[model samples]
Target: MPRSIDRHELWFGSKLNPRRNSLNLIRLVLALAVLVHHCWPLMGLGGGPEFAGEWLGGWAVAGFFSISGYLITGSRLNNRLGDYLVHRVARIMPAFLTCLLFMVVVIAPLGYLAAKGTLSGYLSTTTTPLNYLFSNMFLKMQYADISGGPYGVPYPGAWNGSLWSLYYEFVCYLIIAALGLFALIRKSPWPITIAFVASVLVQANIEKVSVFLGQNYDFVLLMRLLPFFLGGSVLFLWRHRVGLHWIPGILAILSSLIIMSAFPGWGGPACGALVAYALLWISSWLPSPEFVHRNDISYGVYIYAFPVQQLLAVYGLHHFGLAAYMTLSAGITIGLALASWFFVEQPIMKRVRKGKSDSGAPRNESKSSLPEETNGIEKQGSITATTQVN
Candidate 1:
């Protein structure tokens, strides 16, 4: 097996989290998956007719949601309602704005030049320079005038098609936060969690029935994402309670998968219920040394990838062949990832977090020191948790 480590304890949602290395690793892998998906077309080799590979790669987005769910759910619950907004803004905006500026200043101009037949094929352009600039400059909620919602791929020639996922992700954050706020008011978590599952089903139904359903899917998969976030809180509360024997946990995981497969289309509750336990197994069973905790580079990959592959395709590297294209693309992407980690992510996040720590002791307190309490979440951060985004 590929070397596995357990950093679930260190993820962003945890109260005393230094960092979320395991989830970051997962994010990094998902970013690579994004790169490959985009790169494949540029390489001129289709993803091929393999169900598992397609499913796996397509599922990477699901993994992204899962990780976000894990981190944010605990974050929403643990923080002071008022301060949650500030933390969310600080955590998201700096990196997001940085990346957005980069796209407009650097990538869009490159796009423009290519569009006007001035620059060579590190990209190909079927759209006008204005459209190219528009897509890269503003995160369009509806691409090319189609109601594919914001999440679906827009007119391909426009820059940064992948950003559409951010739209859904942000939307997911709102749903969770609102649900979370209601939970706080009612003094209960289960109601909102239950509502979330119902919401996903409603979403799927609206899709099947109404042609107006712009975005729809079995978002029940998203519930699993929440576990990563909530599990961190759970770990903080009950780490001593967890034991490291994997057999029962593994069986439970197997059972969940079996249920998912058998139903293929049913209640999302089963998935939601297992999320906490599934992540628990990841944290306890794995060895600590293997769980290399560190600075995050994954966010950079997430922001930069679409433009990278699209640029490569414009270069006509596909004319050379898939293998050569992938190699070159990976090399370029790695360099970008390293640069993003060093310059954009690490410096900014560190500074913001430090500023918060320096501003006197945290006033917002939780019954326990889980994510809900540690950062002193303000209301603004809660609503705009994922909104001040890249």
Candidate 2:
């Protein structure tokens, strides 16, 4: 028989056991949701599903930020500055760089060969392979194509439109790191609470604020995403007091929908807290397979799916129809994701942990308290979070 629900026993912090949770599964589903959202456009089928004036991928990305905010804040609080940086870098960069290289060496070449019947002059053209790699190596994604190929796709000249958000996610990491430098965030939730409120207000008044900010794209995006991130941060800081009961979770969902319906402009931003709360609540009782708990390939799926979809489009695979196209894309992307986890992400994280262990440095109890399963790259309690589409 299932355990009985007890209102007093449903505090979020207590239910958030690192040993067992559906967060990895939730993240994987979010990453796949992004892939599905892009499938419509990549297949020239118009936008995918939308709710409350936002695309499905937008919601998925918001979920990613919320989860990241909670996990990363915990990570920072429990880790030394240097160890935190190492884990963050190790989790995100290696696979990302490998994906870029794969684009240059494999995907882009195939596109160039298909277009020109040869690989001649492929490296020297505008948006050359080297240019694409170097320009986006830092995560900003200035260049999305290689040698100006990947032509004839629905999203032409963009090998990977999914990478733009990574820069913002990294920026959020830096923001938390900077905040961690202060004793205020460590002792109380006031700092994150104030930041979340300010971000929501800015999002509500983005149009007027854009006038003074000269319509800067980065500023607008940061404002759009920062609230959810801070929402998660605030939740982490207050987890002990926040209950995860089903009644309140349903209320949060309804409240968010009502607010979005009544006030579209700021409703989404204002409901970040509610959204984060609901997500955690759902995760509390969600059942996930043991494989997902042990192996997190969501990050790999995210960074590789875009380019793979573009490559399939370049080959005119969308002509096979959406079902077949999506099937192939998902299969190939999952295979690549598995490879990335085993070859690049997992091994590197293991080495980093090993090095820390070898150094004989004392482990912070908060982090050490996390389940052994979560010690790997992008695991449940790790600060290195996932990314998404633009």
Top of the candidates by TM-score: 2
Candidate 1 lDDT over residue span 132-175, tens digit each: 44554434323321111111122244446566666556656566
Q: What lDDT score is found at residue 110 in candidate 1?
A: 55
Q: Which ranges in model 2 have alpha carbons more than 4 Å from their true place?
A: 1-14, 365-390
Q: Can you write out model 2's per-residue Cα lDDT over 1-390, one digit (the tens) per residue? A: 012335544542225445455777888899999998999999888898988788889889998888787777777876777877777887788889999999899989998888888999998999989888888999988987789878888888888888889899889988998899999888998989999999999999998998898999999998888888888888777765665666788899999889977886678878888888787767666777777766788888898898899889988998999889888999999999989988988788777777877899656432322212222122232123221100
lDDT of each: 0.47, 0.78
TM-score of each: 0.67, 0.90
RMSD of 2: 4.9
Those runs of model 1 whose alpha carbons end farther than 4 Å from true positions after fitting are 1-21, 42-44, 47-54, 111-116, 119-156, 183-187, 208-245, 263-280, 283-292, 361-390
lDDT of 2 at 344: 88
